[model samples]
Target: MFSLFGLTVVPAAAAGGDFAPPGCFGERYGTLFGQGVSVNCFPGEGYGYRVIAHCANGNAFWFVVGEFVPYGFGPAVAECSGALLVPARVVAYEVDEI
Candidate 1:
């Protein structure tokens, strides 16, 4: 286990290699009764990263990954289509070489 961006990175065994997937950590605003969903992610160092907002009504919204910079991009928010829709989960993954 190692620390990355103030978070612990645990290496897991994969089919090809043992490594830790790059991810982000932060706070998510709003609840089941809120108007919109937003996430503030402190993404790990990489080419870039994006936030995915999964809604309760099976709708998924993705925030585009901006250009790579030293400080990175700003926070992003996705609006749920249904009324009083809530976000089931917000995921942030690194946009590494592919």
Candidate 2:
């Protein structure tokens, strides 16, 4: 039923950490959840990891793994604006290490 709308949901624990953010895993992979993920601790700048969330509305989110239950991220959903159900503030995150 939901798959028909192009959604790629996954476990939350697969994309979070508290190690030095991996260089190979810089701010580029996108945002992810951390519920069933398997993270190996390594040396990072304080705490490090990446995420890549495949959302339900054909859009995904990208952010450093944060501390929370499931420790995950869903699509960047803006309020539905217009006279329909379209998102109002359609904001997107662009990963640029600088």
Cα lDDT, all candidates: 0.40, 0.27
Candidate whose lDDT is highest: 1
Model 2: per-residue Cα lDDT over 1-98, one tens digit each:
23545886654453333222343322222222221122333333443333322222325333333222122222212121222332222222221211
**Clashing pairs in model 1, backbone N/Cα/C closer than 3 A:** none
Q: After superposing candidate 2, which stretches have Cα over 4 Å from the reference?
A: 1-38, 48-52, 57-98
Error of 1 at 94 (Å): 10
Off by over 4 Å in 1: 1-23, 31-46, 57-71, 84-98
**What lDDT, from 0 to 1, does candidate 1 have?**
0.40
> What does each candidate score in C-alpha RMSD?
12.1, 13.1
- Please report the candidate that would top TM-score against the real structure: 1
3-96 per-residue lDDT for model 1 (tens digits)? 9889998875443121213343334455454323333345455444433443444455444333333324564445333444443433332323
